[model samples]
Target: MTDDLQSWIGRTRRVADEMATPLVRRMAALTDRSDVALDRGAVVPNHWLTMLFDDAQPQSQLGPDGHPSKGDFLPPVPLPRRMLGGRRLTYHAPVHVGDALERETAIAAITPKVGRSGAMIFVMLRHTITGPNGLLAVEEQDVAYLEAKRNAPAPPEKPAETPTAEWRDAWRPDPVVLFRFSALAFNGHRIHYDADYARDGEGYPALVVNGSVSTLFLFEALLRRNPGRQIASYEARTMQPVFCDRPAFLCADAPGADGARNLWVEKDDGAMAIRIKTRLT
Candidate 1:
């Protein structure tokens, strides 16, 4: 990494926000969990934090890709495309709605590499969340930047093979769902809502689903099936791009001997789009 890029490592920033009840209810509604109590004192799910603390950059500061222009909080890599690569989170305490929360974030690492498509850069960020009660959760997130590829050809499809699972749920994310998710995260990425831009500009066959949305769905499914099971820690990785309006299956295997459950989002073709591992308290 260039010295300039390396300087981004360990850079830290702190911000505060409130866990508003209305936003919590909106999140529940987005996940199709309107039954979730959104009373002021109700506990907010840790996964929902993904939609909070969004970078509210001014319109003039946004790049053509709709994200904040680089060289500010994040390093300015010349790459023209960006996406959420993966995340690992540890829940320390329950965060309640209406609580004022603080988040401290740091750039943990910056890695540059070459891929089949071209040059790439991976940024690792660490976030510590706290409330009046003290520490709430610690999260490590990965963001990837890539070279822009307009009209890129789709990869060849592989043979379908069903994965074993103890529980499964089907979800069809229409444009509305994608749009709402994008809005909730303050994500201005056109690929999630603009089908034309996604196809001709990004070379995606259809609108791409947000990685955080997929992660949220996995957690919702897990918690719904195993109510009251507290998640101590969880890690997730996006294996492939899941498009909007496609029928996807959220699958979870029986807990292993160590009590860690394996979860994944399976595309209609039986490919795993995202995989997760979680341990309960």
Candidate 2:
């Protein structure tokens, strides 16, 4: 392992936390942008659970990419660009609005590999969040870092036609939506907010959408379609980049006999950007 890689492995941080009632209501409101009425002790939805914990790094301490200067909890990968590659979440119990929570974060692994794009580093982070009752969720998230891009490539061609799904909804995500979500999640990533930096610095076409936000949207759609259903497990893979320049649609197939569900998000151009598989209890 490289000196930097050896330095980051096996590091961990545990944060004692609580879920404030006001923030719960605010997240529910920001979620649909409608009049959402929530009380203090109400059971918080799984999707909104992520809004409880904040990274809490001071602004001055952030890096040029707008994230907290790495090497603290996360590894200081030398690559200039970083993004979420995918996530797998296991939800064990429902969290209430005003519950005391504890979150433990650790660097599970740092994998170095060479791909078609270039030299890459895949950092796997394991987050275990527990509530007063018991363990609430265990999530494994993949964070990828890559070398700078010299030439921006054209976007993928639109699929011939979008596949039909039993349950689906369309969303037109704008800058405001992305900004509000970033604020709520305490994500300071410049690629999601800075158009010039995303284009010139990162070689993206426009401000990129947050991958977690996309996952939440799919989760919200799933819950909306099947009320009162709790997700036992969820695995999501980001197939393509979803940009702010176009609309995106969320589609889900009917559940199988085993109660397993399949879902995906398709860009306006009809390309599938994310695929989600879920098991409900």
Candidate 3:
């Protein structure tokens, strides 16, 4: 199975999309920044790039989990569940609204390993995004696939003490926000919006929050404190699942001498749900 999955390492695909004003407005609305400038030449938020180049799979092509059936572009991993593990992004130039963009994605690596939960397969995907001017950004996304559970809820983890931070902001994510985020990202994953499926099917206590949304909250918190600072690069890792309707705290440390900052999302119980490291230009 590993050999078969390894064959997908070099697979690549190219997709093109436009940064429309309406889309930018919707993204602004999602973040409660309805006053964001949406003019043609206005720069789109760096994290908002996830909303572009969506893979609109046909209804019939979707799997039981709501994602496009595997084996075409992605490898056919035998695991029964998948989730976002982490991402590293480097921005070279700002992507403005109305600019037509192209993205080239390739499978960079595939590794199978065993962890506390069980067997897992990790896939790394590399994306190079370009605009009419030149290269905009490059991203490496990590995706993990896991063995199916028997519908039994796993033991809960002990909560950790929250770390102190220079800046902190509280955010409550409800179903409405999760649904809007899923819509914006063109993600049809059932766990993000389906409470019943999340509890019964995935053993989650409630609807899971989108990892991308948590990352966005962290980034926005940083921006709130340091306005106008351009992000040169950032890396985010989802340490745990954050359920919808729960209040989470976005915390960030002051930039170090090197201009790099540390950020994280703290769950209500003080557990660190996500950790991020970012550098400013």
Q: What Cα-based lDDT does every candidate model obtain?
A: 0.85, 0.79, 0.86
Off by over 4 Å in 1: 150-163
The residue-by-residue lDDT of candidate 3 on 94-121, one tens digit each, is: 9898999999999999999886578899
Q: What is the RMSD of candidate 1?
A: 2.1
The weakest ten consecutive residues by lDDT in model 1 span 154-163
Higher-ranked by TM-score: 1 or 3: 3
- How do the predictions measure up, each by TM-score? 0.93, 0.91, 0.95
lDDT tens string, model 2, 135-193? 99999988888888857454454453444588768887789878888887788888888
Task: Quote the positional error of residue 9 for candidate 1 in Å.
Answer: 1.3
Candidate 2, number of clashes: 0
RMSD of each: 2.1, 2.7, 1.7
Selected candidate, larger TM-score, 1 vs 2: 1
Give the range where candidate 2 is weakest over 10 consecutive residues by summed lDDT. 154-163
Candidate 1, number of clashes: 0
Give the TM-score ranking, best first: 3, 1, 2
